[model samples]
Target chain A: MESLLSYAFMQRALLAGFLISITCAILGVFLVLRRDAMIGHGLAHVTFGGVALGLFLYLTPLLVALGVAVFSALGILKLKERAGLYGDTAIGIISSLGMALGIILVSLAGSFNVDLFGYLFGNILAIDPEEVWMALILALVVLITIVLFYQEFVFLTFDPESARTSGVQVRRLDKLMAILTAVTVVLGMKVVGILLVSALLVMPAAAALQVARSFKEALMISASVAGISAIAGLVIAFYFDWPASGTIVAVSGLFFLVLFQARSYRKPAQEELNERV
Target chain B: MSTNSSLIHVDNVSFNFHGLKVLQDISFSISPGDFLALIGPNGSGKTTLIRIILGILKPSSGRIVLMGEEVHQFTQWQRIGYVPQKATLLDPYFPASVREVVAMGLISLKRFPRLLTRQDESSIDKALDRVGLKGLKSRRIGELSGGQQQRVFIARAIVNGPDVLFLDEPTAGVDADTQARFYDMLAELNRKEGLTIVLITHDFGIITKHANKVACLNQRLFFHGTHEEFCSSQAVQDLLRGEHHLVCHRH
Candidate 1:
């Protein structure tokens, strides 16, 4: 463990992984509660297309992916707000277009490049000092935004109709959320890879919801779960020489399953006790 | 009602959804402290009308003036409270206590960085006390019974002490005893607090006893007058007795 910490790559990987996971988990709580859980997955797919376009044009891939993902996220919001499309339907449509664009771009590039492969499977050890700094800055921005608009997001998620009638700027706040989610997804692609980044967002929140008694507890528990999973996954991957991204997602899945089982077992006993009363 | 003193003035309002005429040429004015019941058969545009009045849905034509300002330009939303339909149908796993849910009602009254004040806490307590749910303020909203959940939403709507409150189907699926108690609480709020209330419900038998005015709507305003006038209106009587079956139908 001491020698592992001495390695600069390992230090960068751990810092970036921990920060990205916490950001994803916090945003996941609101998205899952609002039934927009699929937005993360959709945005990740769009990022795939963005990466491909960047490679095709010989531009900075991460920056291009961030731009494409943010644009697509806003597009999804517009489709829902203006066209009245259902959330999942809009996500599905936009994500499909993104993936389609990616496939064409990849085919046109004439060969699957090693650089693109790193994004697909994630190479945390390959994450340089620049990407680590990017993760730190972006994660702080997302967390701060969540803190600033915490109450408004809660109201908007719980009952948008009531929130709007109460004079809350539901549309403006929704766009803010979309932009935040897009940023989180783009940053997360480096830590967990494009394919499994949604797991980092979804699993912790789903597990936390099982036992959380309040929204605050849910957010806290989710961040802890994700942070722990990231650390555990990294340690295990380093020791066993296994894939880090896949291991991280697997750990999150395991947390969800355990929490789900524990919640189910406790529920019947609590109901029986209530009946006795 | 005098237009100057009216809290809500609906002028030739009409709504269309996907080319389907939902409400047409509807006009009425609500006075301060008046308890108005909006009744109609299923799909008769009752919810749509209230949404329009609340600016949730824009009308196809005409205008709505709230508290002297046109609806589109009205910014004093803190003065308006709303309890939407199926308030009790919240997700059973939603992670919010009754207090937290009620605090959402106070969000509109605040600006950016909308933190609750010490006074806001006491107001939440008083609102819960008004709805007789002060003891369950910490309980998770999903844990409450259907009737209790309904009261939680009422507490939320009234937490801000708005001048006018709108409730859409507050008693649906509740037991008869709970339904009677709900109406009694609404009547007390309207009578003692002078809170103007616009309610949408199918329970005519009990609403007529509590509501001072009744508006019969089925894509058009059939009647808008004192409850006593509603009882004697021959047109409404015929609709209620006919296959329209406005009272017995459920949406």
Candidate 2:
């Protein structure tokens, strides 16, 4: 770990990993609760298309990915609202199109070179300070938005009908959430890559919910679990020269299994009590 | 226009979806301190009417007034509470305690951060007390039985102390004993607390016992009158004969 810290690249990767954890864990809790975990997976593919478009156009890749991801995310919302399609169905259509466009653009830009490969599976060693800064700014925006509308999100997630009837501005909040998730997914693609970004968004939250009895507790535990896993994965990857995103996802998966087991182990006691009742 | 006496007024409201008429020329008014039961057959637009009243759906032709303002423009939503039919359809994995679930109703009343003030806490407590779930405030919402979940949702709806309550099939999946207790609680709320209630329910048996007013619908407002007067109405009598199964079927 000390040897890894000497490399600036490793330092940048850790920073990116930490920020991605905070953003993904926060947004993921809501997505998982709302049963929109696939949105992250879908938007990651959309970000891939954006990255390809950026490279093809010789523009700033992150900026272009941000634009495309936001646009496509909003487009998904529109389709869900007006079009006769379920949410996952809309996600399926847009995400597949995104990947297809990305594949075509990558081919058009030249070939599946090292640079493009870095994005697909993540090249943590390639993360620069600039990318770290960009991720922080975008993550800050999402964090502030979540902090501000935290209660509303919980209300909307629990019962959208009650939230709407109580004048919660359900449409605006949903769009805001979509936009936030798009930005986070696009930025997070730098650290965890497109293929595995949603794992970050979903796994820790599921694990936390296994143990937490309340929404706020679940959120805090999820963020902690996610942040810790990213750090732990980075340390192990440095020693083994392993792929950091894959390692982090694996570690989080391990935590989830343990937590789920613990949850089950505790349930028998409660069930026995219920039987007595 | 609004009057001090009436809490809600549905004036010439009509709704259509994809050219299918859901409600046609429906008109009625609900005054303060009245319990109105909206009863109809499966396809008779009861849910649509509730949606229209709650401003969830935009009626195609006419308008509605909620709490003295037009439904489209009314913004004082905290004064009204709505409990949907699928309230108990929450996922088993949903992680929220009873206190937190009831606090959801106070979201509209408070702004960002939503940390409960002393007043808000007491309000949440009172709501739990009202629903007889005070002892289970810290218990997980998903751990409760179906009837208990319904009461939890009712607690959530009334946490903000709304003047009027709207329930769409409040006991949709509940057992008969639970349904009777739930109906009794509702009757107490209406009679003792004088909360104006608009309930969409299937059982006509309880409606005659509790509801002061009843509306029978089948694509149109077949009958709207006092429950006692409704017994004499030919329109409802015709429906009683036409949809006897629906009237006889209770949870």
Scored by lDDT, the top model is 1
Off by over 4 Å in 2: A268-277, B1-4, B242-251
lDDT of 2 by residue, A1-277 (tens): 6788998888888888887887899899999998899999999998889888888887888899889889988999999989978999999999999999998987776775576677778766688888888888888889988988888899899889888998888999999999999998887788778888899899999999998888988889899989899899988888997898899989999999999998986553335323432
State which docking tier applies to candidate 1.
medium
What DockQ number belongs to candidate 1?
0.55
Pairs in steric clash, model 1: none
Which model scores highest in TM-score?
Answer: 1
Candidate 1 lDDT, A1-277, residue by residue in tens: 9988998899999999999999999999999998888999999999999999999999989999999999999999999988999999999999999999999999988976798888888888799988888889999999999999999999999999999999988999999999999999988899889999888889999999998878888999999999999999998999999999999999999999999988877543335323432
Clashes of 2: 0
lDDT of 2 by residue, B76-136 (tens): 9889998998786877668898889888899878866666789988998899898887878
